[model samples]
Target: MTDAPAPKHYAPRWNSDPRPDPPAVGGERETLSAVLDWHRATFELKCAGLPPDRLSEKAVPPSALSLHGLARHLAGVERWWFRIQFADEDVPMLYYSDEDPDQDFDRLDGDVDEAFAVWRAECDRSRQITTAAASLDETGVRKRTGEPISLRRIMVDMIAEYARHNGHADLLRERIDGSIGV
Candidate 1:
């Protein structure tokens, strides 16, 4: 089969996505995959075009939920689920050390561009793994647990992850600026 066209990267922002829309009535795999992609894009939109310091700010008092933290966590989440969990690729943690378990959310010291780049690479690799899988039922072993996981479950979990985190992102963005909705 011929290769799919190279994806174009347009820096995303609230209500300004260059990505394609998902089908309203596609097959199970198509629909699920498309929804996953949409949620991922939503996460990006919520964090786009913010200043580094703004991104790093923990908007909610006593809750370490910054847009920067969300980006870092989501990057690790993508790598955890797709690379370590789904593709079974040997990889190291994106953040978080034994002493700093909340590094992704707590220690926001890295450059924003570097964090975004890591997240983008993970997203691209995730799409590749999903595309190459034979079906949603395709199984991969979980790294830490040594248990089996299905692509279907991973997709659903990822959607939930984005949904939950995007909520935090929305609040963070609103706090950063008065803007809301995407």
Candidate 2:
């Protein structure tokens, strides 16, 4: 008999709200993009079902971390790394300034829905930029240092950034509702 396909492993508990699973085998670009998207979805799922007021709640005392703030910070990061740094686009930085740099996490003003919308838009733009590149080897200048950086490096760095934030999101979500899952 022909060999059977391998069985799926490690199913996520929250099947009702599914997160994208990175391909088991794929090109580097596809793998990186899928992983990043998975992290993005994970972050969104963590914030799901919470009202705007709750979304902005610190949840954990003595810490300014919240789903709303994380959305804002992630959106700014997406724009900063992909649009501004990688594509060299002329766009104003979001939720940040020289004088008030931590505004993304510190000041939780505006509508929570609006923050998520902005974040989704930035993710779309980042994906477009990545797709347009001929290869991961394509280089972009570092605005601060004037050094070249590759698309691969940016994707890897972004993955790390999302991983760290997702961990924070897990804790914030648990403290907020006592719900937890992968």
Candidate 3:
């Protein structure tokens, strides 16, 4: 009996490129909000219509980077910057443990629905914390490091971080499937 050849693997494709024209903004919202919104939308676009396995699949063997892992990392980062840093609350970091400081990106055998739900919940919480700032100039000192940080700075940092990771996710997703942008 002849053995069939292995199925060819296809890369991912994105519909809307990140280099597209920026969204139009009017009064009230600052540049920070616009940046955050762009990153958030990009993240959602990268995650749309992906199955749990694809979302959670590791791009590299034994590497802690995956679409789901990126989502989880962002969730933890949002909590740290907004809740702990901005709100000055003593809350435990999500998915963090002594054994793994970077549990956010660690390989986990979790369902896709659970990951999506967690990501959505965290995104909502992040928006709430960001929107509550009295102004872009509002400052909050980090409890752990005592470094003074402004809401504007935090939001900008978040946007930058998310943008970078989303780029990685885009490439990874493409490698996983022929699916592309939103």
Candidate lDDT scores, in order, read: 0.86, 0.93, 0.75
Give the runs in model 2 whose Cα sits over 4 Å from its true position: 1-12
lDDT of 1 by residue, 53-85 (tens): 888888888898898888899999999998988
44-101 per-residue lDDT for model 3 (tens digits): 7777777778888887666668888888877778788888788777778877777988
Per-residue alpha-carbon lDDT of model 2 for 15-118, expressed as tens digits? 48677679999999999999999989988898899999988999888988899999999999999999999999999999999999999999998999999999
lDDT of model 2 at position 129: 99
Q: How many backbone clashes does every candidate have?
A: 0, 0, 8
TM-score between candidate 2 and the true structure: 0.92
Q: Judging by lDDT, tell me the better candidate of 1 and 3.
A: 1
Candidate 3 residue runs with Cα over 4 Å from true position: 1-29
Relative to the unseen true structure, what is the C-alpha lDDT of residue 60 in candidate 3, on a scale of 0 to 100? 63
In lDDT terms, which candidate is top? 2
* TM-scores of all predicted structures: 0.87, 0.92, 0.79
Worst 10 residues of 3 by lDDT: 12-21
Q: Model 3: clashing residue pairs?
A: 11-174, 11-177, 12-174, 13-179, 13-180, 14-180, 14-181, 15-181
